[model samples]
Target: MEFKPDLAASNPSIDFTNELAQLLLFTGEVGVAIQQFSAYRGNLNNNFSFPSDIEEISQQPALDLMFLSDVISKVSGINRLIRGCIEINNYKELINYLNKTIELYKAYSRPNEQLKEALKGDPYKTFSNTYLKGFVDLDFAISILEAIISKCEQNNVGAKTA
Candidate 1:
């Protein structure tokens, strides 16, 4: 989509700062959390059974290698999307990026049946952030972010509204 700087000027209610901030923070947290998940595995396979001794997994040599590693990786591309959206004011692209992120996250996280079972009720609980606990709401957040980007487009900011 082409950039529309005029829309940003027309619509001044865009909350890019907060959106970008949250995106950056969550992406970082998710990345770190994923790293910590490494400790839950053994260089080969991760023990996913319930009631299993977590200490055992953290003690082995190869397993101990990443004893405190995270399972999620940092999403730099999301940051790039945030920057792109704010810079070019490409609200459409921003939405596309956020949508892509949601897809990627689901695709990567859906396979672990053990993790899925563990997350039974709370689907969006990333690492330890439990305020919204079970109510992840990132799917909603992406929509909101898109709407904000759209508003930015309407306001006619210095950049394009994509």
Candidate 2:
């Protein structure tokens, strides 16, 4: 399916840089939760935070959160597919899920110039880390899957064929 970026869903009316930074911050949360829950999880936190530089991220920094909304959505959807495979013991589906996940991740992890080319019409003209920003987004995306898994495990609702 062709990717469609959704700015409203991805960015919730916050500062763009800190918004990305916030996503990173929650990444740590997901890691910790996975250790504890080992089942379903939720959006670890609101947004991904930035690398802890002494200076705060600029409010007017170049990147557009809108551009990344679609990527995050794609990552999130893949996580769901993978989890569904695990729940049903569908080995073939699991293999396909992993393959697609890797392929999509590679495309999403491309460099800024490539992102610009693929995305087209980047008003910011800013650079993006191959996976840094998207890593959190992808992981955050996966957290929703984690939460669904948790529900099946704990509630036993569709656990057999989640």
Prediction-by-prediction clash tally: 31, 16
Per-candidate Cα lDDT values, in order, are: 0.44, 0.40
TM-score of 1: 0.40
* Candidate RMSDs in order: 10.2, 15.8
Superposed by TM-score, candidate 1 places the C-alpha of residue 160 at a distance from the truth, in angstroms, of 14
Best by lDDT: 1
Tens-digit lDDT track for model 2 on 78-136? 44554444445343443344445444545544454555566663423211332234334
Candidate 1 lDDT over residue span 121-155, tens digit each: 22323312332223233444455455555665576
Instruction: Tell me, by TM-score, which candidate is best.
Output: 1
For residue 14, what is the lDDT in candidate 1? Answer: 55
Candidate 2 TM-score, true structure as reference? 0.33
Runs in model 1 deviating more than 4 A are 1-13, 34-74, 112-162
